[model samples]
Target: MTGILRLLTARRGAGRLHWTDWATYAYLGLAVLLMFGPVLWLVLSSFKTPAALLEFPPSFLPMTQKEVRVEGYPQPLPLFSVTMEDGSTRELAQVRRVGLIAQMVDPKAPGTTVRVAADKRQPVREMAFAVSNYTEPLAKYDFLRFLENSLFVTLIATAITLVINSMAAYALSIYEFKGKTLAMLAVIGTLMIPITIVLVPVYLVVTEMGLVNSLWAVILPGAATPTGVFLLRQYMLTIPRDLIEAARMDKASEWRIYARIVMPLSAPALAVLTIFSIMWRWNDFLWPLAVLTKSEVQTLQIGLNAFQGELQTQWHYLLAMTVVTLTPVAIVFAFLQRFIATGIANTGMK
Candidate 1:
């Protein structure tokens, strides 16, 4: 019994590390890298120049261009630096290339051209940022207008969603009525049907109502999502029926009870739905594309499509605009993430 108690109570030395601990930490490190690696790359790549972007092995950092003088060359050559054979570095300019060997010009002297190894010259690049990537797109493309459109749509849709879904949930959860179970089941049934199945019909309805090309076409259809109704209903079910009864005993109107008592208690769930609604409205591309014909009224996601043309894509500008588009979503998630945890924990309690 003493031996068993000793074994059970034994603690490892503070300095001693276990293999399991190491493995757990390694796994966590890898998980974090996997999750955040692309995001880090995206942010860094947004600052890279077009030449740096096109380099064979991609550079992780942003770079700037510099002009260097070659003795025989009529004009200064655009040269980047590279580490050479003896671990020394040289500034080499790309002139032209044959199948394998690249014709490089030494910018330091005129009439100095050499056949350097192909793809071997790294541009003598300094850490550079092209603010123009963001500025030009915003100024030329009217990205601010699209951003405003997205914000307006997201806020209005989210507010309407919360009010309508909460009301539906309150009615279903608290009130005793005939066919209540069937009604709840019907709400859940909508979940099985993919939104794609209803896309054409919804669009047709919007067109018939003459709401095509209007932001309302986007906002009105999704104002009361079945998923929101289900989430709030599940949460509202956890609220005590007695409190609602007590409110009723005070002769409180149903709307008064819901607005004052239920909405306050269900705040966590509301926050979760708010985040979801924002993401939905912000990232929605296809429907907005179909409904919104004019560029002035489009969302940020639609505006981003302008960066791609028939012949070429402006990846730098696209990436910078992408970063701008993501900022608001990140801010919203950061602020409300705590509520998500609270909602899940409280919902699980009942």
Candidate 2:
């Protein structure tokens, strides 16, 4: 009994030490910084002012440094105005105010000037916290409409993609038929074809179908992803043939077996496909940009274009809007991180 307990304890301690090794900690630390570093900068910069934004070597937090302090009373600066000499009119001449030490010295009272200098340092401009920085100019853009359109397209694309790709994948995975290899070869062959080469053709097809500048143009193009079909088919092929046969013997139709048995079993691969679909659709800028011409119809990716002018770009407003635009995708990815994990775990089971 004593020998067995010692062996078990040694094994457990060895396992613990292995997992907590320096290499493991190093990898973990690098992974965390890669994932969260940019996000930290974005959240911190969102609350900063325009001056502080451009301030070199930047302060990450809001400016709390005081710039100006008043002792007795708030002295408002005088506004100078000039008048024409043609009418022999007198006018206030423009001049920069001198430092407090020089003003107090007054040539006649140089003694008091030293005392005044000792009493006060130049006032620093009070640190201005512009909450409006994060709020104001950001309100000027039409992100709500962009967000709505993006949501509509992403949801529709994901659902339709899952359905269509799963059906195609199921057919490719289970059934043995003539021309099967030929069909798959053709499918895979198209993967190598550059989308740019097909751009004009796709545009014409949409134009012929009267889908120009419509939501359908964006949603429908991505509904049938070749990669999703391929990934799902490969994963589904790993399902045991006996399970599928048993389902059919129990009076289950192929579609029902697919829905009830195959889909549930293929969750990891499906998850992988789902992540890819969401990311691709979400990041789909070019196609949506090509399809959507009106600002009202534009997607989130194109919202950045709204603030950009031919000669100038609004950096501060652009940064604020970019932070907002990135937020939802980040949230979605965070929630779906499990899907990516499973996808990686079960990538090549077959």
Worst 10 residues of 2 by lDDT: 101-110
lDDT of each: 0.86, 0.70
Window of ten residues with lowest summed lDDT in model 1: 7-16
Give Cα distance to truth, residue 323, candidate 2, Å.
Answer: 2.6
lDDT of 1 by residue, 120-195 (tens): 6765667888778889988999999999999999999999999999999999989999999999999989989988
Q: Best candidate per TM-score, number? A: 1
Clashes of 2: 6
Candidate 2 lDDT over residue span 72-110, tens digit each: 325432222223334432212111345532222222222
Off by over 4 Å in 1: 1-13, 64-66, 69-76, 80-122, 345-350
Q: Report per-prediction Cα RMSD to one decimal.
A: 6.1, 10.3
Winner by lDDT: 1
